[model samples]
Structures are given as structure tokens and as C-alpha cells.
Target chain A: MVEQGGGASGAGCMGCPLRQRSEWCVLNEEETRFLSRHLKKRRYRAGETIFSAGEPSHGVYCVASGTAAIRKGNAEGNTVLLRLAYPGDTLGYRGLLLGENRRYGAEALGPSKVCFVDRAVVKLLLERNPALGQQFLRRIARDMDEAHDHLVRNATLSNRDKFIHLLRALMNRHGRTATDGGHFMELPLSRRDLASMIGARHETLSRIIGRLEEDGIARFSGRTVYVARSHWLLNDSRPPTLLD
Target chain B: MVEQGGGASGAGCMGCPLRQRSEWCVLNEEETRFLSRHLKKRRYRAGETIFSAGEPSHGVYCVASGTAAIRKGNAEGNTVLLRLAYPGDTLGYRGLLLGENRRYGAEALGPSKVCFVDRAVVKLLLERNPALGQQFLRRIARDMDEAHDHLVRNATLSNRDKFIHLLRALMNRHGRTATDGGHFMELPLSRRDLASMIGARHETLSRIIGRLEEDGIARFSGRTVYVARSHWLLNDSRPPTLLD
Candidate 1:
């Protein structure tokens, strides 16, 4: 929660890698200059909460380094991981835009540095650039679509199918090419975290992973999972063609 | 699926009740007049599909009358009910705003009349009024928040809690006050649809409802349901307090 402003010249917004690659950082020269003036860089330790649910929406955070977990809780006080956000990803725009309390909480998965841009500054930028506003709108819309897809999957898919889909999604989101002509993903969390993300019990997750391994779909050792054959998984990930 | 643009004058935007009540219709007189010029109204029969997933996003639809079900198919090719769109509610804005294909399919719950506004015209209106753009942004943000809440509920809440919470939500959204100090809800769909919504099998849903009746929490008869009390349901609906 500590804010470190006026450090853009040091290790902050100046020449940040996310500016060149992140979709949310698609800002023009003037916009970038404005960000350099207002963005505050905050550092967080692993597992430290960046923001909690019901907190006022004062600003947004762009993860400059390390990863973050976005989580929500139910009526029974159990928290579920909604999504894992990676470096260069933006967070908290929903609360800022909606003028509501935060619906989910975010925590640093590891030592991370995130740049916080004030809500007023962000609104001013949107007013000056409608395209920027549209970009953010598109991002939020995509989030809603993903949530809907998750709901459908949870309600209808078998546990095995859900497990494979989760791996495929993780591969697509944060995979690296393995030397053995396969995909490898290094998740920031452990099996328990993955189990929570896919809404499966730990023993059930283990049983399914064993089954998938037997079926030659994917293999996991430690936090790094290797996918030897992705064709079936990829095919399974294809949403049923809507009867248009 | 049928296009009848010029027939708008007979059943369209002119004198539409939604224009007065919908937050999406928070436009100046000038924008309202513009809507009158370009919006087309269409009628759909019960059980008829309004739009399917993967359809190109050309415009947005506002439910003028009747109700519609928004659904998405799971990996098993079975469709799940996502939510219901009622009069004064807008649909398809997610795809339209994101410039992506429609993620969910919509169909008439009963006979529904919905008005369509062209994407080009909507964009023009947004450019003309930034406040209107903010309103839409806020609406989309709220939608994302609700989606996150749903994800958490599905993952963390027990089956009984989930069922009760869904009823409370439906009652809050579309219930009518009964004469006997209870709440009455006339769901456009049947028990099967309700079963799909709560992700419960028909037999399990029946058992839960019977249990609730024994507890004197609620009662369902045909298409109408009556809740003898709401305070307990409302109290149960509050999300768990997040551990900051």
C-alpha cells in the first residue's frame, strides 16, 4: 500500500518493457509522458495483497515484474482463484471504471513491482483519447466473456476435460517451447493452487493428472508442466461451433 | 435472425418504454432523436433464437419487452444458462464493444420484442458524449464484477447455498411483492431451465426445493414461486467478508 511517486526517472515508467509489448500500454508519446508524470511505482513481497475486496477504487496497477493472483470469495468464506495475471498485465480497471468496491482481491505471487496510475489521471486520459477508452472497454468485455466460458465449463465439462482445458489455457497464456518439441509452462503456484483454479479437490486433481499422463496428454513435475502432445488438448479447447 | 429494418416505425424505438428506464438509454434529447431514426424493433417467438454464438457483432440489442436467456455451451457441447435479459436490459454490448465474436447465444424466453441499434450509430453517439461512454464503461465493469462473483459462487458455495442464493438474486432482480407480505416471481422458463441455471440435476433440484419448502423458506407452483420470507435469504446472499 505504500506509494513511491516521482521515481519514474529511476526504476519506474522510464523505458519500461511493458510499454513496448503490453496491450494495455498502447499509449502515444503524449500519453506516455503523462504517465511518467503521474504513475507511482509500488513494490510488494510474495503473497502480499496488493488490494483487497471492498476497498475503494482509487487507481489501477500495471504489473511491471513478477506475477499476481486475482481471487474472489464465496458466502462460505472460501476463496477461489479467478485468474493468474502475469507481468505486463493491468489490474483494477473494473473497480476504477465502475466506481464500485473491488469485487476481487489481488496479491503478488512473488516479489513484484507494479506501477499505479491514479484514477483521476486515468479518467483524464480516457477523456482525451477515446481509443484508449475503447481499448479498456474491450479488455473488460473479454474478461466477462472468459468468466462466462468458465461457468459453462464448470457446469458441463467432466473433471478430466476441465483439467486438460486448464493446461491448454495455461500453455496458451504463459507457455514456453520445450527443447523436446513440446510446450512447457512454469506456473507461479503449486498443484493446490491449480486445483482451486479448476474447482477440483486435491485428490481428484491428482487422479486426473495421473490419467492424463497415462493417456499421453501432459506431464507435470514440480511447478513446471510439460505437454508432449498438445493436439488433443488444443482440439478439446476449441469451443463448440455455434450453430449460426 | 430476420432483418426488417424499415418496419421500425411500427414496433421500434419510438415511444419505447426502455428509452425512459434503461441506463443504456442515458442519452441527451439529441441522442434519443438519433435513436428514433436508426433503431429497428423486432419480435421473436418463444423458444426462438435471437442470436447465436460466433455471430459477427454488428450492433447491440435492447430488450424492450419480454425476457431472453443468454446461454453458452460447455466442452461437452451442452448449453448452460448464463443469465436472463429482461426489459430495460441491453444485450450483445460485450461483443460489440470488444470487436469480438458473440461469446454467448441468446433466445426468447417467451415472446420478446427487442430494439437493435447499429454499431456505427452507437460509436457516433459515444464520440459525441463522453459521459455516455463512461456510462457504458461503468455498465461493462459492473457486468465483469457480477461475472467474477458468479465464478466464486460456483466454485466455493455448497449446492444448497448456491440454490438459495440464485433464488434470492432472481427475486431481487425480477420478483414482484405478493399481497401476503411474501415475494412472488413469475419465471418465464420452467423447472428444467431453473435446474440448468443452478447446475443441478432435476432430481436434486426437486429434493432441494422440497427441503426448502419444509423449512418454510420458499414455495414453487407451476411458473410462479412465492417466498414466505426474504430477510434470511438476503442475509445469506452477502458475499463473505474478504480477508484483507
Candidate 2:
């Protein structure tokens, strides 16, 4: 069933991982209590949209578990995968605080649980707590920095370099080093998602992956991937010039 | 002589155009007074850098007059013009508030006057006034949105379309409608600066502008450009299909 978004109670927010982690969501005692009162948990299945573009923002959603993709469409109507949202990351705060409609859509990659807090409480907390406002500002600034970097990369990097960059980013986030020292991981996104991320077509992505496998740089079986040449993928001193 | 940046008196913040206009800068009476005490004016000549990438941000710069370009470099070390900061726009707040090094450099596009407010006082004002915090948040959100839009344009639009889009943006911001109903504007930036904004080489930009002039879509005599065929450039219904 596609849970189309509504108030669905899942768990308490008193000791939620996002709240407990100072590095992730820092909420003081009073602010935490205030947010806890308005917290409502919601779940989504694989390929479900947590929110859509142009929709009114109710509040921020804190992801508790599972992965999701932030997607936006270009002027030519081509979809681009902006970034992936992981556990402990908050979403929708940008639109909510700015009082603007959603510019991008958030879609779940797998079974995901997210806690939503109302905008009213958020505004109140921001007004009352200067530290929390600063945290929000920092988070937004980091996001802006990442977006700017992506713009630069999209313009400068070749499709092959971009794929390697994306793979390395995913590996850093979700890879588990095997006994043989090769990093292995199951891709959370499909080929189409990966292509959108690298600003390439799905067929192009398939061709690139096939070439990488043939060259012994990467190995993929279904959604599972192993970077045989992790060093090459992450080589910063001198990158291999792979022509597209 | 290059102004390496120092305290220079230009204008008072009290009753300044930015502060007097609610839509521009939203500071309350008390907050404005507090900011006025610490406000130092600085003026920059054309091609002067107000701030640089990787530099320590001392405070926020509120543009009092004239326009400036915000620039950043890509991974390949190519300079990209990120944005144009106009009068009433605030720069360096992102770095100051986040306590991070400047990600992009700000350079005056023409003779520009800017008011600098110390970060310590800005923080104090933010804490004391919730509206000021909200205003900053909105400004940052808008910047993020514009950056995202630029990313999408870079990925999808053809070079010709991108140039037209750039022209349209400039015309909207700084153009004056002439007697013949055509938008007339002085190009604040040189071909090099314009090229960087659209991720194109300076030679390519020159060629495109030359073609536009030859085709009667635009006329450029040195720094002065007259867009005679503004309709052609601003046509949303159908875009010229130019092969890259």
C-alpha cells in the first residue's frame, strides 16, 4: 500500500536517534519537549514519494530509518536526483521555514519511517531558541554549499568521472569492507536514479558500468556492487582519464 | 590601485535605502540602531574583489549601491560566476553565521558601495530579534533555490539557450525600457565575466554575442548592448534549437 501521507503514529520522540545525536538534530530540553508534542510518525514503502514538488509544507520530517532520494526536475522536464537523505537527516524545513512550496520531491528508496513536526512549533522554537536557529542556518548553509558543488561538478566532470564520484560517495556512506578488503555494498538506488544523479541516460549508465566491469574496476551482480579498484575510484592525486 | 579591503566611510546605515525599504532589509528600529553603531562603509572599484574564496569572513556585507559578482571555481580550476549581488542584497552572512570559510568570492561588477556589519553584532541582533533571523533564513533559501535552478539549467539547456536565459535575467534585473519599447542596459560585466556565469569559455561567449548581433537579435557596441529582438530572446513558447 502506498501511504499517501497523513498523521500516523509510529513511535515516541523522547529518545529518538535524530534528537539524541548532537551532530544530527540538536534540540534542547524545552525545544525537544515542544517538538515531541507535535511529532507524528509516518511510514512509506519502496518507491513512495514522501512529498511532491509545489506541495505545501506542513513541517520538517526527520528520517529515522531507510534511505530516500531528493529529486528535482529541470526546465526541460528531465528529472535529476539531487541527493540522498539518510537516517537522522531532516527534510522540508527549507520550504516550511521559508513559507514556500516544495521545490523538490522526496521519494523513498525503500521501506522508511519518518517523524514530522508542525511548522508552528518549529517557528516558535526558532524564535525562542537562538541556538536552534543557528543550527538550522548552518544546516541550510551546508546544503547550499553541496548544491553549488554539484553545479560545478555537473559542468566540469565527464560522465565517467561523475559516475565514479557518485559511486565513491555511495561507498563512503554505505560500503562495508569485505574480508578480501574490497568494498561491497548493495546500491540503494536503481540504475535510472544513478543516471539521473550523474546527468546521464539510463542506457549510458549501463554502458559505463559494463565498461568499468570489463576493465576490472568494478563488479556488479544485480543491485550488489563491489569496487575491485577502490584505489582507482578514489584516486585524488591522478585520476584515470576515461573517455565517454 | 586595488582596494585590498579596509574600513572606509561611504554612507550611514540610518535612513539608507536598504534599511528604509522593508522589502529589502527588515531590521526593527532598535535592531537598526544597534547595527548603525557598528556599520562601516566600504567602496570598491570595478573588478575589485570584496571577498575571496577560503578567506575568513569578518562580517556581513550589505550592498548599499552598485552591483557585484559572486564567483566560484570548479574542480577543474575553471572560474564560474555564481551570481550577481545587487543593491540591498546581503553577502558573507552565510560564511559568518555558519562559522565557515568563504566558499565563493565577491567582486564588484562596477563601482559599488557596501556597508559592513560585524558578525558579533549580527549574532546579537539575530538573538534579540526573531524577524531578522527569519529574514536571513528567507534570503538563504532564495539563494539556494537560484543555485539549484542554475544547476538544472547547466545540465539541460543548450549554450545558446543559456546565453539567452542569462540575457533575460540581466534585462529583468537592470534593463531600462527604451523609447522604442526595447530593453536597453549597460553591460555591467565584460565578456569574460559573462562567460564564467554561464559556464562557457570567453571565446565562445564572444562568438555567441557576435552571432546574436549579426542576426539582429541583439546589438553590442563595446560595453553598450541593445536587445532589439527582446521578444526572440524572451520567447517562452518556443526556443531556438541551436546545436552545441
Per DockQ, the best of the predicted structures is 1
- Candidate 1: what lDDT? 0.76
Off by over 4 Å in 1: A1-14, A23-25, A173-175, A203-221, A230-244, B1-15, B213-217, B230-244
Instruction: Output the worst ten-in-a-row residue range by lDDT, candidate 2 chain B.
Output: B1-10
- DockQ metric for all predictions: 0.66, 0.59
- Place model 1 in a CAPRI quality band: medium
Candidate 2 TM-score restricted to chain A: 0.88
For each model, chain A TM-score? 0.85, 0.88
| Candidate 2, DockQ score (0 to 1) | 0.59
Error of 2 at B159 (Å): 2.3
lDDT of 1 by residue, A17-113 (tens): 6776554466777777787778888888999999999899899988888889998887567778899787778899988877778878999999988
Model 2 bad stretches (over 4 Å): A1-11, A22-25, A29-34, A229-244, B1-11, B21-24, B210-216, B230-244
Count of backbone collisions within predicted model 1? 0
Best by TM-score: 2
Looking at candidate 2, what is the lDDT of residue B38?
73
